[model samples]
Target: MRQRNFRVRSTVVAAVMVFSTVALAQPAAPLPATGNLQPETRAAQALPSLAPLVESVKSAVVNVEVVAKVSSSRGGMGDSPLDRFFGGGRGGSRENVRQGAGSGFIVDPKGLVLTNNHVVEDAVSISVKLDDGRSFPAEILGRDPLTDVAVIKLKGKVEGLPVVGLGDSDAVKVGDWVLAIGNPFGLASSVSLGILSAKARNIEAGPYDDFLQTDAAINPGNSGGPLFNMKGEVIGINTAIVGGGTGIGFSVPSNLVKALVPMLEKEGAVTRGYLGIQIQDLTADLGKALNLPVTEGAIINDVTSGSPSAKAGLKLDDVVVAIDGQKVGSANALTRVVALKRPGTVSTLTLYRNGNKQDLKVTLGTRPDIEGIGKRTPRETEESSKARVGVSLSDLDARTAQQAGFTRNEGGALITDVVPGSPAERADLAPGMLVVEANRKPIRSAEELAAAIKATPSGGTLLLRVLAPGANSRFLRALKVP
Candidate 1:
């Protein structure tokens, strides 16, 4: 036979396979004399199906339709009868209408539906269609953009509506069978089968991005749909998928939904606990530089002034090992634990500073809205000096300091250029970064920074605190000296 290769295209397609088993003739094995052992033969069992599970939960899955007003600057509208009748066809109204479709599921017998925020956000009118050909209008109850979860209530007398049973997403494991029901391409009651590929996935979709990854065939219209376990319980909400990729999709875990739904119903928004600290995961290189035994905690990069963390005396370079006795293995783990706590909660943090362990109680505050950093023009200067770490440094002038969101008194050695393929570049030290401190000592000028670098023994690590331009945050960088 001629050898040939086949490649599968990137699209969501259903596949089914069947196998037939045949018995072949074989010689019987001789039995032992006294204690003979016999092999047990069992009948072949039928493959499992999702038909009954789909039938029981399909009624709760709904199709969400949204209409919003859009502003267009186009000259005239097309030849629609309504548009011509409304605006005499000269320069039709600039206000146009847009429509979108998504999926949702009923979570309350009183007609309360759970869906994604992007589906009904900014919608002028919203309507929901059921699997039984019943359509009803819906109004947004509350939405949390941070988590991308929304709650909407159907209008009119919607008594005895079918509701989906919520499952414990924390109990789910990888490789567990899962089913997704949604409206794909406006086709209502569509179902897809897959298995849980992973958990606690952070796709950078949002700040709280603990998503359940699956290989389900979720499409554009599957957002806000329910991802069910074999027990016919909603374990996740279908949320995102990779563009131009097949069998890769993500869903919001149901536990997060369960936590936020009641709060959304009571309040219009969610208020998360704030630590007021910028942190990053510790790496082996950073651990070695910091003289730590293990790299399993989140290292504090910066503490906001007058914030909860600052008030609690949490300083820069402190490694948080645990929060409220819960081990924080990574930066994301710390973030999730802190954000799950309510405001005004006094939580104990186990942290290490200078290789010494300590505990501190911090009363978390309400998380504020994320502020945008402003940009500043970089000042050009001819005077520059070279540091041993392959970086060109310059004196930070008062004017340049103030322009870079720093006070005049906070003078430091500004990095003007970084040599490519050098230790400085490898440590992520770039131009436009201001080196404030070296080895726990303040650096006032380029000459001071050079002196600090030279004082360090050859082949030793130099820990430097630096601030990026256009932001009010500081971070530590560890560079190995030659």
Candidate 2:
């Protein structure tokens, strides 16, 4: 049995040796010295091109021209019908017309175009020039400056228009190849390529400041242009470019644009939900001090009296962990989630108060129209005067005292309102806060508080003791009174 097994093993080894020699004796194929052109190499050498994508969607991009009237010392030959008929061509009274340009894309087949609000803002006449050199009078339907988005429509008959496809901005990620198509410097149909640099960027444009950052050569005339992904889908609207900075451009994510467009279309305006609460992020230090298990939540600093949050029993120092079970990790997150909710929607807010999780149902209220937003926003201008403390104080009447959760004997002025840009607002003196004392003196009325502020020594800090309605409410804050 041993001899038979050895014979079988030796035959197998001989066959392997014979095969190895034959393979070694075979001559190698003579090819270029570089390397083998394998299947994968050929496939990899094929670079992705944007030719087809650009060609497919280029026609949908339209050039927006806005003719606005400007003041001039001498009137030019150009005159409006109102100016010509009214004989208002005085040298100083004459107005000059200037044209501004931007870009947009056709969203609907019936000739609805979407662009940035600033493009056609305050224009006396608006026109959209298509790729085929067809110019049509355009009417501004609505605009939302908070997001810098606007929806315009083609007036008169419009048909057979090519529309650009909208992509999911949420699915877009950093390093994804994108193309920005716009009219840079009024040169129409210019295309630039770059990767998405970042997402959810806050440039302090407005309350809803989340934007998508890209390096796609966006410029002044590129505002309202389309930022297309490799799939030829519009994922962002190229909006602003950083001055003196290369490759830093911003775009409004299409998801947010899509959400706001419907409201802009229906009501020609955008309305947000207001919770009426001053909130801050639960930072690491705040979490530690509050004995929170996780540092991801929004902490309520002050709840507005007579507001939805105040009516819903939301209190100071309560950490909002989730909205409708969706986790909230920051103040911005909570603000966005609540703002996106429609008014009259009862949202289940899960809160963490003193290490105990509690659920509160909050009915959202309509956000008031802010001063410098929406289609009816006023033209840009410098603020002429700064507020003293940014707070509007009122004598504590019985109703006001009750609203502030204080008795008539509290001996303080009730803060009825807080100006957006004020020293008091900066010091976190919001509405419904009782100014118990100013300059270490008991504040009995608005006049007393004003006198205390007037007597503040130059460069001296105005010490104030503000009382809120809660367990951990009484606190002293200092504001620099110059």
Candidate 3:
């Protein structure tokens, strides 16, 4: 199969897992004899011994039910001064709870199960129901929201349980037949068959979004179930499906979990190496401008000072071609490869610099909590208009300012909150930094900023160099605004 590295948005997972190369040659084997069935009946049998394989693994699969408790807030004036003094300004409170369900599979005999992080997050109570209808309380061991993977432990001993064998998802070809067995729509033990559809898709769900795409019929309740190959090995964990498609689905490769489970069991969390840099896909014009021979690998737009990349002497405008011999052609690929390394590990990066290949060794650092970035909904794009100078503005939040390495001081329209996923976030226009100018025009409030933006000609470019915290930093960005 094609060994491209790509991140997948949730639905994007179903699209990329289908890209596999042609099948390789292998010797065919003769069928084994059945003892009880008549000799003539062998010709009509669909599968020789699939029953034993299914029976062996079924005990490990489970149905997960979760309940989350939510508290409601109330605010109003108190009836009396004395009552207000005792109870404060807030009134009575009400408690509410929501129920959800999902699926999971036991990975160890001691009762450790694997499921999606989103499936059991914030749950106050979790229970796992086995195939024989026996249920046990489950406790979440740890979860990785960036990858949407979670591990949970169950009470009591359950020995001799058949564990699903993990297969190499990187080796699974597109035309290879696969099976998906899960509790779909709450239906017990639903089995669906399909072929690999694509691989290495960039759906934009998270940084490390690599997923296995399949045409297997997976639905709402199938979230953590296993996607098996013909040999009954778990190649992937069924995770998501396209909202409108019937047969399109996606799964987390079993290989990824194979690497994650041990770490979760030991540390109660997964630690990943980080190199602070902003990267972008290589475009034809950009490639030619950089004088690079090929439009492959990710281009470094900016590198944070004092970061691991900076310590390694990585520079802006450098193109990363590989990481420790692993080829990376996209930003998602770079993220995934970096995540595979430990925090203290030294990684060698092969980069294309001014049309020459050079190598640099970088001691990686642990990534900070990144669950909040990329969580905001994408902003709407507007028609571009040319206007006189003034800085564009948005609300000031701790997150916005921290990204720009600035302290939250002045409020009002913080620069660089516009949508459409561009370098505005890179322009260093962060929240808490007041927008002092637009097209060279002084802007005092939102009204002035709006007026300045409106004065620009429709379908033209606008520029604003704003003063932010620390040294007054200038901001530059281009957009079509209506």
Candidate 4:
């Protein structure tokens, strides 16, 4: 019986081995041709693959290696904006040489590579490694921290370098497929697929916060990589990702990069056109208060003395509706449009003042260096008055004015208290703030502010030019009277 069982098992094993060999030898069946099928059926049968697109553009992507010396007293090598998001560095007694890696794409045949500014910032030595295994030392051409864009030139480059074409970021729509090729976590030639999750994302990274958000698995080493659209055109440059969140990444739009690249390459820095004015978005309440027909545009809060806007006659409460025929939908839009023009270029601004539209041609000026404002403690006031708009105000005395960073002769009404749930509190009015003007008229005392509020018609709006304590600039606020 045992001999019979052993022979049966051996036979079964031989049969199974023979069947596996035959199955392995057979080739995969070809998919049926869809040429003669119905349109819907054909679409269903043909699956889309990014293999061809990847093959075409992958050569343009390169790896960037940086070596820099960082102080031990500071956060060390990982103290950069990019490193803060990804995390690195350690404290020590002496300065240390840190080596980091990032990614970039060639934008010119002469080895011009566009990347994020933080990638090669403060680098003592830089190297670029092509996807085709070629490597060369590189030098920083220029870098702009405001836009987080940088241009680097590859040294000792011969010829035939693959270059990626820039695409119109304005044309990109949400949900459009995007490809991100980079060296994530030092893994070279890594490709990720996702859609343009959002556009014009303001992550507060810089003054120009317009970023294209995507879910394309952007990692630490992916900084400064190119984000490609379906046409293999670069639409954005991957700059940042969420700290510990998945499927959330930010890229600087290519249009912004395109605007900055020429200046960066030629001058090694960006010189933006400046109109010296503090502005804010025209909200619905502000529009209604100003009796504006439309609730869009940038409302001038304060005009810098002797600045371009001041010289052009722009004043507080003026609403800029358009710039050279381009609509200014928000304050940020106005800023971006103005900054794009070269200094000394005359640009026409269409604005609304007193419910009338007017155009002003003003030559742009170069942006000046920003001065810091020092903070001071709020001084006590003896006199106080209550207003119908639900706020207690006091006279802005000379000592308090100087402490608040204003001239000792400056006259205004200081807010001593704001009623909870009242219009004052709702408009973000808080104690220690000074009301400099009411309805475009200067206020010298708490009684003057109360008089201005009393003069406003029932259910009307009270426009206040307010100077917050310890602030360097003034802002305009519209409060509705009950």
TM-score for all models, in order of appearance: 0.64, 0.64, 0.63, 0.67
| CA lDDT of every candidate | 0.76, 0.74, 0.66, 0.77
Residue 369 CA displacement from its true place in model 4, Å: 3.3
Candidate 4 per-residue lDDT over residues 1-482, each given as its tens digit: 00001111101011112333456668889876667678999786685888999999999999998754444455533434433422334675544445677889999999899988777765545679999899877777877777778898887734899999999999999999999999876788999999999999877666668889999887777888999999999999998776544568889899999999998887777778999999999999999999999899999999999999999999889999999999999998898888888999999999999999999999899876452212111110101223245577888778877765665547788887775445577778888888989989999887899878767754578999998777779999897764
Candidate 1 lDDT tens digits, 243-308: 654568889999999988977777756778999999999888988899988789999999999999
**Tens digits of per-residue lDDT for model 3, 1-482:** 00011121121111223466664696566566587678668666755656666776776778877653333344543222111111223445643333456678887778888887666654545778888877876667776666677788875556655466678888898888888877665666767878889887556657788888999887766777888887778888877676645567878888788878777666657788899999998877888999988777899999988889999999988999899999888888898889878998998999998889899999999887766423211111111211112134555456766665566544435554332122233344444456656676666565666666666553345565565667655565553322
Provide the clashing-pair count of each candidate structure. 0, 2, 32, 0
Q: What residue runs in model 4 are displaced by over 4 Å at the alpha carbon?
A: 1-45, 75-79, 82-89, 92-94, 371-482
Point out where model 3 deviates above 4 Å. 1-53, 70-95, 373-482
Q: Please identify model 1 stretches exceeding 4 Å from their true place.
A: 1-45, 71-95, 371-482
Root-mean-square deviation (CA) per prediction? 25.1, 27.1, 21.8, 25.6
The better candidate by TM-score, 1 or 4, is 4
Q: Given candidate 1, what's the lDDT at residue 141?
A: 76
Candidate 3: clashing residue pairs, number: 32
* 139-216 per-residue lDDT for model 2 (tens digits): 677777667788888866688888997899999999999999987766789899999999998776667767899988
